[model samples]
Target chain A: MPGAETPIETIISMMVGRTLSNDALVIPDTASQPVALEVRNLNRGREIRDVSFAVRKGEILGFAGLMGAGRTEVARAIFGADRRESGDIFVHGQRVSISTPKDAVAAGIGYLSEDRKHFGLATGLDVRNNVALASLERFTSPIGVLDEAGMQREAVSYIRQLAIKTPSDTQEARLLSGGNQQKVVIAKWLLRDCDILIFDEPTRGIDVGAKSEIYKLLNALAAQGKAIIVISSELPEVLRLSHRIAVMCEGRLTGILPGGASQEEIMGLATLREPAMAVRHAS
Target chain B: MTDTTAPAPAAKTGPRISGAFHRLLAFSGLIALIVAFSLASPNFLQTQNILAILQATSVNGVLAIAATLVIITGGIDLSVGTLMTFCAVVAGVILTYWGLPLPVGILGAILAGAASGLVSGTIIAKLKVPPFIATLGMMLILKGLSLVISGTKPIYFNDTPGFNQIALGSFIGQIFPAVPLPNGVLVLFAVALIAAFVLSKTALGRYTFALGSNEEAVRLSGVNIDRWKIAVYSVTGAICGVAGLLIASRLNSAQPALGQGYELDAIAAVVIGGTSLSGGRGTVLGTLIGALIISVLANGLRILSVAQEWQTVVTGCIIILAVYADILRRRAL
Candidate 1:
């Protein structure tokens, strides 16, 4: 354990002593066993050196950083809504290429985008339809006829499962409150059997009571061994919810730390930029 | 400050009064027209005048019902007018030139309208063109096609001797000789009843409102919005086909020039009857009332010796007033 810090401490002390170039901090493997998702050497050929990380099953891996940190970009990349110039992504130890949101779903990956109102739901549909949308195949017959009764029964289960406060499944989504909308989004992914979940800015505008419920839901989902990755701007949220925390700065992974790590430690790594070191490599 | 909430008697009475007011307005409009027209001209009270009004409403009312479906989906079908005309021309071609059976001619006519609607729907849905642009293009296309097909002349349905009877004949009148209501009126009512039922009771109907209400929400819900949008246009098209049959039968000919302006009248009737052009809220009953209002106004104004140009101007003004009134009501809500 002491030996682990020796190299890092030596590097820091060397930089402090010589006031040398703020670069060449050797990085170590941050991923753990039973990898849920792994990105290895993503876009290594570009100006921005490709980095890698892994999320373990049943763990809340919180991603925290300041603005322009590429935290949301990483989440979007994994969700397949954004392109990775070159990277090998493995879901449940199986390498996969996801080019679109539909592909991500097919791989049992569910993404709750930051902008839930626009991308996550069809606001005009009733509660039941939004819940059943991603799983329409289960509700329709071979001949393309909708089984209304079957769909309704399944919807009732989700409404009960999510404890969605609505008169019935027929209540339109637009009529529901913000928290209810978030729950509906969760219910959609849950219905789709998505084991790997990416939640970005999960409680951005949700009220206090609803935020508590969402935290509880995330904990519950993690307890069930779902690979959960949360992207957040809130410090307390990242500190409290994560089992491990990953810090990003300037579109690069600055460092990874245990969840119990202090805000100062995370911020120190986030602001740890090696400007001349990157420039030195260029020369 | 202490009164957090209180239901005043007057506040509670408002909704009931409003409901009653609308019904009263429509019912009274119909009655007042009948009474006034009957008093002004003895000829107006005659069964012939009554039948004539009903007959006039049949075609426009049916088209309005079709337009109601499209408008409710937050879309419009401007081509419905020429599409109807094109359908009639097809029917005329089938009956008079191709020498097909009367039933076949009717079938051909309806299918022709539906096919055009399907094309418009495809252009709008699959091509990602807005409904206005797609349907506007379709309107012109159908107009040109009709004129070219008919060679800028009316095609008489003389070869199919019984074709005119489809509209002018009165089976219901024969059964109940006291009323003598034409079969065309009955057909119109039958179509309206069925359209209303489909809109209210079917999954397609619910989605129609859903599309107008929030199309993206519907798509996120995993509905094939393109397919549903196409279905709506196709249904509207099929109804247009029905309107074409009624019109051609009524005139005993397919007049290409007659359909170039009918869409405005149908749309006006729908709006006047209380259907919102923005979609999400509408009723077949409203379209019926709207159709009757236009017919009564025209019949009454003609009796009052209003010039034809003045009648057109009055109709235009009424459309604006009706739309403005709707805006006021929405703002009040």
Candidate 2:
């Protein structure tokens, strides 16, 4: 019975728990928006070779590629989670030097890594602590003592706002579902007030109901004018979410397509290898 | 659509209950040891013998506290024992050989310890050397340096007045005239209280657990993890400096060769106190109780005329049991 349901019906059922009139997915026109982040000729060994792109304000720029196509590498380079051989990153038209994740965060860039267990969540710590970790200075006194009550208050607020299904803020992060864990990561960046968010595999292991919730959350964040770059291997996810799509193959950005581009168009560019137009852009 | 069942929320009180359970288990074990020893030997319950056990625990307790900080960062400082000796020798050179003021000598020892710790931290953090190997190398280097600096001789604190009082004197007896607790026990309690506060209430303590729990995650959170790790090691070294002073003042001499095996005792105490050897979760109170447990076991067995070798065997058995208990607790979780 579930297999017979249409994709829209499933999403709708997951959203409201019942069927409703269809609302079209609006593709925001980001052409006139200011460029929030721009990378010029970013190079990182062989995995990322002279790759460049720009993400504008209020835009969901989806990165599409096959496995090992260097999409994650480019995200890491831009976020300064990895050493970049050479690159110029301009945030809001000002070039900022970011060599470490600390500098990247100081420059208002947040990276939600694909490896949630190792790089996104301190599973042994509680949800409140994890959410407050990136912004601990705000909850710390001049004498370096933590304001635990304040942290707990903020954590409870985020739990309610994000609909995180935890019994309490003190619940250990490892015990939470994958979707809730991802929300905790999102709450961390939100608390840090990061302007540029790079989400790698935002819904990789999440279930369908939680997956729809994440999609809604991402669209809401873009609606709030946050610059979001989503790197997902799922073509339908890219098609449904991105205002613009960037396709990569063999460490090169093969092409950029507008939102609503056909799956065949994305697949074609995903497998394209150093074509003349792609070569010209690299130079 | 059929796969939309909500994930079972974790038991609301699981971790909290288990944490309290572990501390209770350790505490009850300590109490059981005290009772058994008291029943087996009449002298074990005496006030003097009790004071002796507390005094014996002082140095190792302080050192174990130091290890707790580093271990919570998922690091091991094998150099803590020799580093303590190295600090004592530095104090000796300042107080006896150089004829410096007592305060200066004390400050010199602590600063020397901090500097050595800073070096160890830099090697591990900046050079990307693993913590175990770096500290192991530091352990040997410090042991050799202690012998070289002290000229293979014990450095006496005869030139420093009131030095022996630093550990042997009883400030509480001077106040109440009832309980004559040694200054060393007082120092242990003070150190434990301060360490507990730091671990619970300070940002440094937060990062210590975070680093152990998931270091890469902490780094990706935009934290300067290297700086924090280095700070943890430096603080640990400084605590070892305090331990050095306690031992030196207790004996009125810095015995260079007397420190090689002390590290094992300190680590044992930390493990028995319910602090995870793998890091992340630990407590200073647990360490203090752990140190007390070791001291009690040693003193009780000695009172009952157990051979020193058998005492060591018993200790080895306890350490294994404690670690196994921890593994079982984690598995239950």
The lDDT, on a scale of 0 to 1, for candidate 2 is: 0.90
lDDT of 2 by residue, A1-283 (tens): 4575558667667655654433356898888999999999998777998898999999999999999999999999887888999989999999999999999999999999988998999988999999998998888899989999999999999888888889899999988989889999999999999989999999988866677778888888998899999999999888888889999998889899998899999999998977675689889
Q: Which stretches of candidate 1 lie over 4 Å from their true place?
A: A1-158, A167-172, A188-200, A222-231, A242-283, B1-48
Candidate 1 global Cα RMSD:
10.7
The CAPRI-style docking tier of model 1 reads: incorrect
User: Which stretch of 10 consecutive residues in model 2 chain B shows the poorest summed lDDT?
Assistant: B1-10
RMSD of each: 10.7, 3.3
Fnat of candidate 2, please? 0.57
Clashing pairs in 2: none
TM-score of chain A of each: 0.83, 0.91
Among all windows of ten consecutive residues in candidate 1 chain B, which has the lowest summed lDDT?
Answer: B1-10
Q: Write the per-residue lDDT of candidate 1 for residues A95-190, one digit (tens) a residue.
A: 988776667787888888787777776665677877877776676656455677877888888777767767678876765667777888888889
